[model samples]
Target: MNAKTETPAIPEGACITAKVPERGTALLGDVVVNPYKLAPLTAIIRDGGQAISAAHVRVLGRGERGVDIAYEVSERSLWTYGGIPVFGLYPDHVNQVEVTYKLDGERIRERYQVYAPAVRLPVVANQTAALPLVEPIKVAPGFEHRLYLFNHLLGEIPGGRAFKWNALGGAAEWDQVGNNWIADSNGDVRWYLDIEQIHDSGRRDGLGGTMGFQQTRDGKLIWGQGQTYSKYDLLGRRVWQRALPDKFADFSHEIRETPNGTYLLRVGTSDYRRPDNKRVRSIRDHIIEVNEAGDVLDFWDLNQILDPYRGELLETLGKAAIQLPEGVQKQESTAANELLEGDLPFGDTPGVGTGRNWAHVNAIDYDASDDSIIISARHQGVVKIGRNKEVKWILASPQGWPERLKAKVLTPVNAKGEALAEEGGLYAEGFDWSWTQHTAWLTGKGTLSVFDNGWGRNFSPTKLAGNYSRAVEYRIDEAKGTVEQLWEYGKERGDEWYSPVTSVVEYRADRDTQFIYSASVGFLTPEKLTTTVLNEVKYGTQDVQVELKVSSRQPGSVGYRALVIDLARAFS
Candidate 1:
């Protein structure tokens, strides 16, 4: 025998015809697997003649670790008469899918055996493991039904020829993993966005990846990073991707859809000049609203709206050398001194990672009821501003504020409506302002919910040992200029649950629960390993219904935020 050749096995239901199948026939037509190359596990079922009014797809589990993933295909015009998209298949396995769809007022059920090849995730420099190592710690009853999306940062050790600021190891490292992924309650990876499809792989600056991953009302996913933002459908179809206008640079943190279909972006201004006409690069101090055409409709320059030189909290944390992570003490204290000693010059400073890291804004939310914007500034405080750029109120301590802005600071009040005593920026027993907070959003009941990072609490360096982070809710009376604490969690856990930076708090009205993400937990440990913890706590009882932890073999892998995604709602 000359040779033995083996032919590849053809997948069941694979399209083999030379001509394209026609639509509007009596029965189902050709089935094309992975029609969109980006989504390898998804398939499209071509419709025959009848219009599909509804669809439900289920991918059965394989082993003990696998769990069934199911969802309904949306009946939008994009899919009613066209091919039905199938999601939630397992990788590298022959998946058994159960599909139920309604066509021409009649119900039809079918079975599918689709094979999805395994995909190899990108590996960062000096790291052997791939991205995203999810570990489930606690899964309460019914919690397994929900899926969570994590924005992961893959830590890459810098090469030789270190800079002066290399002492801040974890803080100085750049992220190599640039994609956001989803995992079930059982810790199985379900889906992820191929960031290279929208962004260039060569460009990795300014947070190094995407953030603010959220779904729009029309079931499209959106995120912002570096200098661009993108929108995509669930089937990995790119709707549109746009870069910041010429005047802006480094779009970080957040990008959310407004009520009128515009987008509110947290971005940095280009060629920002100081009051003395000194040109300098600004970072994380600007917000812009843009239309679908990427035209800037409005902008908010914090340098103009607020006091940029007011670095009371920045100075406090700098002096303590506690800005980065807790136990990782600064090798040289001069970095902090240089930033606080005098007015910063035009160029980048020694201590600051970027140019002029003042008023480090990390989050923004739009209030459609009054067209106001709420922002969480890590260096300043959570603030709400009117459409005219006038400060409606500030949710921060009254100390060290300019007289004009101090008047806008809200007073802490007790449940009984009594003003709480403030001593050195510390409020009495029940209420305290959020410190280094993130994700300050208005809840359905009109209360403000914040992830109080509790950094530099009470603005006292000596009180650092008692610091703790929490998901806190406050009831604010704008007319009375007062805020009352409604509920809180995580303080009781103390330092064990503290997250020095980057976290989120979300309220789920349907479940009557609060989702809290402690993204940077244990960042300051001696080992330098970081763990992300997510908890779903019942509102009134304060009982944790679900607790999930995400860790990685790659040291210093830290998560920025975790979002609970309801697949059925997102797809349908």
Candidate 2:
């Protein structure tokens, strides 16, 4: 269809803009645009079914010539929401946009007034009023940092707020909350704004989503919406987006920026069918080097590299492999599957899928110190790959496997950092060692920090009593082939804090604090939804400094990743 020939003439009052008036000012602190949460202005154009060929926004500043801002607009597809699309606005600035759209044999111009208002948040002066849902706990006092949270999926709350996708084949009741919050030293939220909504593909699979909804040093948001990795500017406009190759399939759970202007993305390709018509869910993980502009620079597939060690992995799967439940096979083709997983945050359906989520890579962290990368595989174990792509070591609980198979795994060290020669590979059982974990990174002290979701914490064969989650730090001595547990939080909280799915652990040296954010803290229950909690604690002593917990206020709510940083530093 030739757009120019099919387009019709413009109608009177054809160009208009709609504003979802601000409910109230959220205390956004300053006038600086926080790129991670800026809302872009929207406009509509009606041209008698003539498509808008091209459109641009001209921002008119005081005493200055208009600055043209490039905008990406398309016809609205949803029937209920009908509007010609316009976006890419400057936040918190009152200005006039001279919008021009190329139509049938002519250019139509329209001027619209728009404003991005600033929000003034309240100071947390009282604990009782800070959070009214839970009991009044003594919060820390006089805090100055802000917390950014990216929940993989937010189940519909009691209120009318609803997310767009429902992977469970139920209602589209889940949403992604990319929110920013300010907390006092006592851990009470003084100000907050639900800046953006995102979708996390791995939320429902018991494997979490991207380890980051992180803002780059230059204030650009870098995140994964399923198979595609995208970047958005401060004005909430998607500036760049890149998808994995068809062979690479979809993003698993992590993406990180390199010292150079590039990214390390963890993604996977499924090998569910063979030439012989056999069916098996064999997910092969890979790490692709991506440039700042969202181009793939390089890639390394772990499956090919670790194929020799397949027997070892099979042994590690042991009881888990046998006990795994069968799921439904999707009726769609791979091409159709790709379309479904594209910009949206849904790839493999949680339970109803053909492939086994084997080697579910959930987190990737680059160790610049050693020129290596540490990856967390929820179904297997954490593996460190050197610059040459050599598997330096594999760290796991090594319990379910046969004693002889433990030789293939790494050894562990005691309190004194002394290697237990006989106890190599097998760490203390029952929620002590790493298992079904997410988010692994190097601490300032050169130890590995992990968010252990405590999956299979109470395996039937192992019969471990408790099922709980915790933020744990381990000192790994590659030279000695040993891993030592340095410290942990939530070990005493029991299942009350057992977040089996999404979570994060951040250790801040400047503030001597450890922040633990959980997406679903409550027991995975059907009667009620789960709650997410953000806890700030004294780093070394594990003293409770502050705690901010929020839920959808609806049954079965869940969230994803969380982190805290200085707001001023983040923006400036």
Candidate 3:
């Protein structure tokens, strides 16, 4: 029997249709599904006769694990949606997706083949090039750390490998932590512990790419990759895995542990249909607090938090063919669906993965002192949200902003405490607002340390001439709503190097000198790929303490983020 004939037919008025990719399978049966841009397959369902309330969608990958999907009916009548997200499929492999729903006490089923494409590395002419002049300075003797790095898109790079780099010797070490580590692709958890001694079929081909990794003082290996947030002990044992709610997946970036034993997960939420007939698609950043039992305790919706300023945002940042959630539609401006992407409120563009890059919120850190959350929205700017759901302060350029919107931004100043010329009282003099920034955290000195990716600097009205990356420290005064750039470390080598995406700067205070760990440095283009690097610099002197340029086996490859941690503490 043919594949279609083998599948059972549904009753009248009940049909399932593909909503996302516009169709099932590739055009002309080419099987061309971009692995990196795998979209969730949403099947719109309309059941007749007795109203269908819930459905169980079971996904069995041809050569992968099984995923159980739960679909519930909303306020809408007789129609419910079921989806098997991209994360549930094995790349380069076909999956058997089965959907079962009941009507009039009878069970109905539907099945289809989900073809996932293989990883196709970007074409690069030069795989290896001569070393650039990376002048490295001396470190404060006896100070060393282990730099943990994960290749941004592992299989997409020719020879990209996620491993630890010994800061003292400046060499990549893969076996330091363990030859085996665990990773979650879709919902399948792969455990590769002791490759030589023991074997597991589900072991990933290589260590999967991670946006962030942390080893707590107690020795729990916490990591957030793809859409899953997981924790493991030093022995490579799984502790807990978060079963994130549907419609919200892809924890593509940062996750941190709060002081209260809760996990702060930076997740991507998309495809929120509003009531106004606008099929809204957005990769909105979300910070959800997950407790020890993998229960979401608290959540701060960034899109909703910033929705009130939609009018000013459109006017200031320029308009685009954008759609906001229903919550943000309370007040309206000359709102239309015709605007350039560069002029979008958050510098987002219609591109890979979701087709709408609303706000690339990469990193989020919790501040216990004030009970606020600091988020690095790469496409927009840095934001500090208070416990009371108020935007406490914002750090971004106010070039084309209206007077009312400008008042919401904190005025920037130079290192010498000199206010830059104020264009509507929101302009800065010495330095512009950080563009395409990342990895911001509250410092012990009551300042914000950020990895300023510097992607937006060149386009600023008051542009900082060279393309470069800087480890910046900013002092944000919430009461006065003012910001002071306390110190910044870049511009020594001009535009010799800059990371337009995925980088970090962590403050380290010791006896004699103050240092910052800067890692995941790379160059970014509008094409959305980077060439990575790592840097360690001293605080006051702005001297390069220790640096590791790209000596990757994969010449044109990059990593997402990096960190400097104690080698003993990390592997222990």
Which 10 consecutive residues of model 3 have the lowest summed lDDT? 168-177
Reference-based lDDT, each prediction: 0.70, 0.52, 0.48
Q: Per-residue error at 199 for model 1, in Å? A: 4.6
State the lDDT of candidate 2 residue by residue for 268-342, as single tens digits.
654434223443333435788878666677877664443212222332322434212225222223333323322
Better TM-score candidate (1, 2): 1
TM-score of each: 0.83, 0.61, 0.58
By TM-score, the candidates rank as 1, 2, 3
Q: Which 10-residue window in model 2 sums to the lowest lDDT?
A: 1-10
Task: Report the lDDT of model 3 for residue 477.
Answer: 74
- lDDT, candidate 3, equals 0.48
Please give, for residues 336-380, the per-residue lDDT of candidate 1 as tens digits: 433443453322221232346767788888898889999998888
Candidate 2's TM-score reads 0.61
How many backbone clashes does every candidate have?
Answer: 4, 20, 5
